[model samples]
Target: MSSTTQTPEATVAVVGGRLVTPDSVIEGGVRIDGQEIAEVGDIDADAETVIDADGQLVLPGLVDLHGDDIEQHLQPRSGARMDASMALASADRANVAAGITTKFHAISFELDEETDRSPELAATMTDAIVDATDLLVDHRLHARCEVTQKRCVDAVLDVLDNGDADLVSVMSHIPGKGQFRDMAAFRSYYENSSNHTAEEAQEMIEERMSIPMETIRDRINRILDRAHERGVVTASHDDENPREVERLAESGVDITEYPITLETAQRASEVGMTTAMGAPNLVRGESQWGNLATIDGIEEGVVDTLVADYHPPSLLAAVFVETGESLPERVKRVSAAPADAAGFTERGRIQPDKRADLIVVDPEPTPTVTEAVVAGQPVYRADATTGESQ
Candidate 1:
């Protein structure tokens, strides 16, 4: 799903469930008119469609703040990429089944020819997502603009100017440093995924690492200037220290994604920037990259929102794992808080006049996603025994 540009207009009645919204919970039914939630009450009202949400929990559809899985689908392997449309459809299906109603497909547009290089491929993939918006659930582009790739930046700007891009993030994946700055780790990552031999991966890493940090900073500033001019929401990636957090705050970046330390997250919070951590980090009880755990940020009261990041199912599962907080309190970590941070006023809550993005989960020993409604249209439903979209 590339865009959330369309919504349905029919009325739907979802009854016999506990409604979980931004501000309140009701043991009743929710009414949806096309895409916007028309009402929430206990009256067993009937509409064109009626869902039997008996003994279930109804809440807002999961809103993923950031993710790179879409790109993974587009290019599953280095050389064995799938058709763009088919990849998108499959990814969207996977996300919907995992309870995400709104998804931000993080597509990296970095033009290069080394282990990670492609201009035509990036354009083709992004265009495919933009063009296929109507056929999927609420979808939007979260362009991970790599500053090192100048040509890729140009392509991304063209797409942004054409109103094809929704959310834009300034990313710098320098060869030997930052997110994968360690030469050994970088080589391992390349060798594990691509057609590169271990020797070739080392050589590529050495070649890229030789570039000065000043050059990297300059490229980032250029991208930031262009991004700010377009009125796009800008975010800093993988910030690991207080200095990095301060630098990003000074640049007027309002969102901090994946801060690597608790101090960094605290600094971001003090400056009023929203801190986003991966939900998987909480579920796994540790950061996969050995960075500061998101649970730490939450404990310190510094983390504001949760993103699905790489795995869609982690969002719902993480809520259950959260200790000490009530289900309603834990929900703010993913639902209302992220919506406010992303500046989406119409979503993230169950309220009058809000978009009707909701899911019905049967709260068994293990919760089950029973029905999912997007913009008042029933998009997914599980059978009594078969987990299928009805």
Candidate 2:
């Protein structure tokens, strides 16, 4: 949660844009001196660069706490692979175009024999992400450790100890609970993703379930301890029940990600833990796999942040879909809330002396990003006709 180096002694003013603040949207301008916001509201100061935003809404750049879209860019096909550094550079541009100035790439340490998400590959990707100094946006790693993968615990510890991970989330994907509560859905997912037959999937599930709960707990605690030692944030994923939520909260989990039911989400909220739901779930109106609807969770006042999850662009669109709340309130779910949850307090809002990570969106007919400025530097500008970043 460190601020980027300030933009060299250059002043840029975004004029005539509707500034979306925490409580209201004011029709004014923002002045950026160096990398921090120098002034906001009715700025009339002469600046070296003036970007006209007459017909756009200037909001804080989106902060995505968890996004796995980079995995698609890295390994588009089952056997096909792209250079990790090249894929990370592409991911940076794509995220900035989607108005995401701060993002945490969710890399998995689930070294299953049936898939390519191995520990070695995860390490390589982590190094690539860390070495991507040319990226236009701030990038971090969310090391998703599959607790059931006992052999991968050392690998997860290595990443945490090496300072490659900013956040660590422990996930237990045992069948008959959590995301795969429905056995039928579990079978379908396993078969479709791994090309396994029903019998093979069932056998795999049985084998995974055979691992002792004590073993799983020990592995998870080890990961959490290492994360704590490194001062990295920790979260629990796919919490299924109130008991599980309470256990994770008691274990000092900072956030609860994708709680499967309203009761579970409520439990997390009651325990004062931040709750995160997927933006795609809100936009799709339901969970792709059978689970609590994100919109419903939002209505119930349980969800605190909205993560892009699999679709980076869905973050902005999800803000518009939340018509019940004001634009400022809805935008926080994708920006300030997530940033604060991830311990990034400097760049989530438009305030004086804060990092100038902002985006301008045109909300006529359909909401689209017109320009994205990160740390006072304009990184992505959309073509007026095609709406693609130039």
| CA deviation > 4 Å runs, candidate 1 | 1-9, 111-117
Which candidate should be chosen as best, given TM-score against the real structure?
2
lDDT string for model 1 (1-390, tens) is 444443455678888888876566678888877778788876547788899888688878888879778766776777666888888898888887777877878777875455344767767767777778554477777777776666767777776787666677777665544567565677777787556788877776665666677876776676667667877677878877788778877877878899877898999898878899999999999988777898888888888888999888888887788567777777777777777776786887788788887888876666667788877778888884765667
Runs in model 2 lying further than 4 Å from the true structure: 1-6, 197-200
lDDT of 2 by residue, 184-208 (tens): 7777898988547778898879987
For each candidate in the order shown, give its overall lDDT on alpha carbons: 0.76, 0.87
Instruction: Supply the TM-score for candidate 2.
Output: 0.96
Best by lDDT: 2
Question: What shift in Å separates residue 96 of candidate 1 from its native position after superposition?
Answer: 1.1
Model 2: worst 10 consecutive residues (lDDT sum): 1-10
Q: Per-prediction RMSD in angstroms? A: 2.4, 1.7
Instruction: Give the local distance difference test score of model 2.
Output: 0.87
Distance from true position, residue 20, model 1, in Å? 1.5
